[model samples]
Target: MAENRSILVVGLGRFGSAVATTLDSMGQDVLAVDKDPLLVNRWSSSIPTVQADMTDVLAIEQLNAADFDTAVVAIGDSVEASVITAGNLLDAGISDIWAKSVSKEHARILQRIGARHIVNAETDAGNRIGHLVSGNYLDYIELEGEYNVVKIHTPTYLIGYTIGDAKVLERYGITVVGIKSPGHEFEYGSSNLVMHRNDELIIMGKQDQIDRFIKG
Candidate 1:
């Protein structure tokens, strides 16, 4: 099992509420905070909540924000409030801060202020959808640099061949990590494993290599 985290979540809007509730469900010790008493009250039964303006340094100090090393600033509407809240978290010595960014400018400000992670939901969703629309990948995960992991339908040319016979890694510069056939669980990839027409392969490689393999 994964170790539980203690996270402080500021703001109670849609994004903030989602993060708080998800973390709470995952058995994390989550303390949700917002300036609005109504928002605090609404979530109190589900998770611990505090009604305090996070933009105020004194309020953050009162909360003893340092007790939780990780925090998320879910305030995406107002750039000023978001920046101030994140700044306050930094001032309180919270080590890892994740913030929501409304724009490139907002993201730049958060980065400049030492926020460890910034998420722009819309931008990310758009990019993911763009990849899926190509009809090649069943799913895709982008990793650091140019690396990617993708799930794709087994190519027709390889239907009757094994991994070794196809020389997949030698020719394509990508590894077939796992394969899932119709009506069956995923199995680890091996040199002798036969490629079936209906199998879905989980491949890992650099972007250019993946693109070439997919196009071929």
Candidate 2:
């Protein structure tokens, strides 16, 4: 049960409210606390709403941060308040803290002050959706600067071929990281298995090489 883990969203703005609503709608137990009762009212029973000044460390502490494993700080506009509230959440003994940042400098400050994760909210969502729509690539997550992960339908040319016969890595720059076959056991040895039609393949390689291979 995702909603049973307990989530605390401190700010009830657009971003925070969305997160809380989504989590609550999915059957998770969510506690949304905000300084503005009006903001709490606007959530409309989507989540367990409460009114409290998140900036006040004492008020935040009263929420029993130790009981919740993760807390999200979505304070917008007031960087200082957001950071302070994040710091309080950390000091109060929560394990994971995710904050929304407005800029690089603010993100760095939050990192230095101990936010475990920071999201760009607006840009990240757009970029992720854009990547999913761009060909079969879902955008690379690696930091080495030369590799990417992609999802592609197994090519008909390679179907019914053994790994030894296909030599995908030798012929193409990409390598198969995972292959999925429906209604079959997952323990099949690599040496004994051959690719089948409509199988899903997870491949990794350079962007240019992957593009060439896809088009080839």
lDDT of 1 by residue, 32-110 (tens): 8999899899999998899999998889889989898588888867999999999989988886888889999999999
After best superposition, candidate 1 residue 93: deviation in angstroms? Answer: 1.1
lDDT of 2 by residue, 119-189 (tens): 78766542232233233443334326788776666676777886557777777867777777777654332
Cα deviation in Å at residue 185, candidate 2? 20
User: Residue 33 of model 2: what lDDT?
Assistant: 87
What candidate 2 gets wrong by more than 4 Å, as runs, is 1-3, 126-216
State each candidate's clash count.
Answer: 0, 2
By lDDT, the best candidate is 1
Off-target runs (Cα >4 Å) in candidate 1 are: 123-216
